[model samples]
Target chain A: MIRFVLACLVACGMLGSVSVCHYMLTRSPVTEPPTSIQPTLRSESALQTPHRTPDQQADTTVSPSRIQLQNNDAARRFFLILTSGFNTAPDPFALGSDGLTEPTRLSAQYGDKSIITLLNDLLRGESIRSSEFDVADTDITRGTLTLFIRATPAETDARIPCPLRIDLIRADGFPCDTYTLWTPGNGVMLTGEATLNPVPGSNTAALGWELVK
Target chain B: MIFRNIYWIFWLHLLLNSMIPCSSARAEPLFTVVASTTQIADLAREIAGDRCRVISILGPGINPHGYMPVPNDGKTVASADLCLQNGLHLEGKNWMATLVRDNGNRPIITCSDGIIPLHLDYDGTVVDDPHAWFDPRNAAIYVNNILKGLIVMDPEGASQYTARASLYLNQLRVLDAWITEQFHQIPPEKRILVTSHDAFNYFAARFGLTVRSPVGWSTGAEIGGGMTPERRRHVVASIREGQVPAVFVETTVNPKIIEQIAQEAGVRIGGHLYSDAMGPAGSAGERYIGMMRENTLTIVEALSR
Candidate 1:
């Protein structure tokens, strides 16, 4: 009887040990919380939190400096080509002997410098290798200009040294001509209706254009 | 004794069974995303929620136009399952896009797609304006594109992404309406916006304002280097002719040229506007909506006089 009782006790102890072991092994393994459950890398509010700059605390007033201009020969040549028909005050809407309309004189004053520089760069045969914005022709007689402006790269933060192309077509001119100026490297093209207005008290004509949606 | 042996064997068998590990309850892997800028990253995160991990290559206060991808950025791109960019050459030569493309052939979502781009008339070329996010309506398109990309990458989270995106879209619509209301306070004639760069064209187009700046549409236009006599003279003349009440500087650009122009034109600096990039984290212009609001408020405060 003692032997049987001892055996039963031993069996019960063994069963208890086995049950605990089974629970431990079959139970899900302890894991660190999923990365998703961890605090987000950046919260909207956290992003909104200002990273203060030294200039932020300063007064709004800033000292002025002398305006200086760099004479880019390429820019000068491109401007000359762009404004070739400007001196003549030709009717921008009238078709020339050629198939295209007469080259309308545009105000050089309204030209963006970045566009000037980029045209200069491209016309000087600067190969942007990636996008073919090479100057095809500067033929003014035809009143038709063909340019291979490089396409803006699709990156959000890339500031390549290119120009944003802005094309202006006269709203009222018959067979309206399109003139383009672009910001350097930003692919923003601003297309508008360009009308030439005779500058008061001056022989030259100014571009009368407004942005179109 | 035989019964005892049987009991021992049974106990051993139970122990062996217990040692076998269960193969259930594995957590789903988190989708990894790499965005070119903070704005895109924020959009991805808002849409992705817990379903994805979004990282931005350009952090707070960094100018995307001048951003060069470091090697670590390449590593981040390598680990990403999807990439998002603003597209339209907003990345200043598409360096970020090129980096991602070089890293792998993963699907890249250009958020600027499907939005009617505002163009700048440069000579005779019409270039697409990269700053479409200036208008909240365009931002809605961005959210939609991001949502579509997320759904395509992780179809399992489609319902969640759709729900989150819908909520975000609602918020954007509210923002757009609020912007319209704010702009209404300023008189049409007084709605002239003079800034350091021509970044506010979209904002101007959306809210009926005129934008004049010494610099062209981009801050990368050779800050001091590109400042020609003609450009400087034109900007100053525009300010004087338009009677522009005030000129504003930009957060990402050097305000020196604009300050000079303002001083030369005898106009006070209205306020600094966030252009090209959003303000630093914790700034009034930190989020896209907040940035637009701050800009509108600054414009109204200066121009509404």
Candidate 2:
């Protein structure tokens, strides 16, 4: 009976010690500042600079150092061209032969300097290639963008129900210079009313315009 | 009977005492973590500090754009109790969509969801720009969102998370102030930014900088082939005129064109800018903070004097 009492007392003692230790470990005390390190904007500055720099006394514009302009030339007008096209349907030919008339077409006209952005309104997994149109009379300024597509002409022999999607690009062809997956945009319309036409019976279509100043 | 009861009580006491240390050791985390990359897999480590593991999937130098899914990525995503991502389509809508589609249980938090995005005026097609993290102010929003998510995920460590987040947020504010101060070194006119793509709109708008690009907002577009001869001449002229002191290249995009532009216009290619992706690890541009700091330093050095 004495031993039982002793055990109870020890157990309670252990619990009390643990509680006290936990309290000590977790306790955060707030203390009054001794006035020397008290936070104030003026006090901070006084601590930083016993002798204030003359520049801080009065707001004066420091003479800005000018860089020697090397090969200084006037700003020129740059034109950026944007084309809208997509392959909504699969190509008819699986052999993947390059044709003249591509599945889509892009054309642009701008005067001097212009910056244009072509938005590919396709989901991430979707794919599009550049060879879908003949980039006639156009030269790519930046080599960053490269596209490939096989061109096929519209057939005159029979009245096809839907325009066949020509194999604009081979399976191994580089479709876009930079693949922008998940890029979204509405259908391409120039001048607020014109919409690019889809290949007559095929799901693919083309829209072209020039962004120039 | 009393002796038997006393023996049972002693064993129980011993068992409870033995568990006390283990429970106390795990009572709270020892540190607070903030990661810039979404690819980190150590979510538990970040919020839980030393107490748990934290991982990020996209870290320094990883391109969330055009990032292909790997088998390990799936495991990381599955193992994480909470995941944070830069939404606003910055993760290449495909990446974010796929992650959400795959993880049914975990919340794929969008850090940039609440912040207003800069709209890209693509000839009147006003769309919310996804590159909000480019600006430090916007990045503050992202950090706050991460803090909220971390606290919610690990409510037990709420105090730790809050404290860490506040500390980190103060650092971010310092970074912002530093960037502004460093920018003052450059003359106002020299603040014009010409990059390979239009990825710096938010940064430009926030910092009173003018941005021009060979390409538009999305780097995935065909920007080069669309330039007309007159437009080419204009860019050539911009180089000759010295309106733009330096042109920057993007990490994921090719720099050849910008280099060529530099050659034509006689301006130097300022430096490589982290756009769709970050710099390789160990480089100054590796982490989010490092990347921003390096960019500011590079900009100040190149444009200032």
Model 1 misplaced stretches (Cα beyond 4 Å) = A1-213, B1-29, B221-225
Q: Lowest summed-lDDT stretch of 10 residues in model 2 chain A?
A: A66-75
Task: Please report the candidate that would top lDDT against the real structure.
Answer: 1
Distance from true location, Cα of A170 in model 2, Å = 85
Q: Can you write out model 1's per-residue Cα lDDT over A3-76, one digit (the tens) per residue? A: 65676777677668767866776577799876665543432122211222333212111122100101221211
Candidate 1 lDDT tens digits, B1-305 = 77778666766765665455433234444899999987788778888987788888887767787677889988898899999999888887798779888897667889888778888765456678888888766777788778878888989899899889877765765566567667878878788888876678888897789887776655675222246689889889988998889999888889899889999999999998888777787898767777888988988899887
Give the C-alpha interface root-mean-square deviation per candidate. 19.3, 19.8
In candidate 2 the C-alpha lDDT for residue A212 amounts to 22
Per-residue C-alpha lDDT of model 2 across residues A1-213, encoded as one tens digit per residue? 777778778877877786677676657786877667664333212222112244331211112220111111111112122322333321112111012112222222222311121232322123333222322111211111122222111222111221212122212221211111111111111121111111111111121112121
- Name the fnat for model 2: 0.07
- Give the root-mean-square deviation of each candidate in angstroms: 26.5, 27.9
What is the lDDT of every predicted structure here? 0.60, 0.49
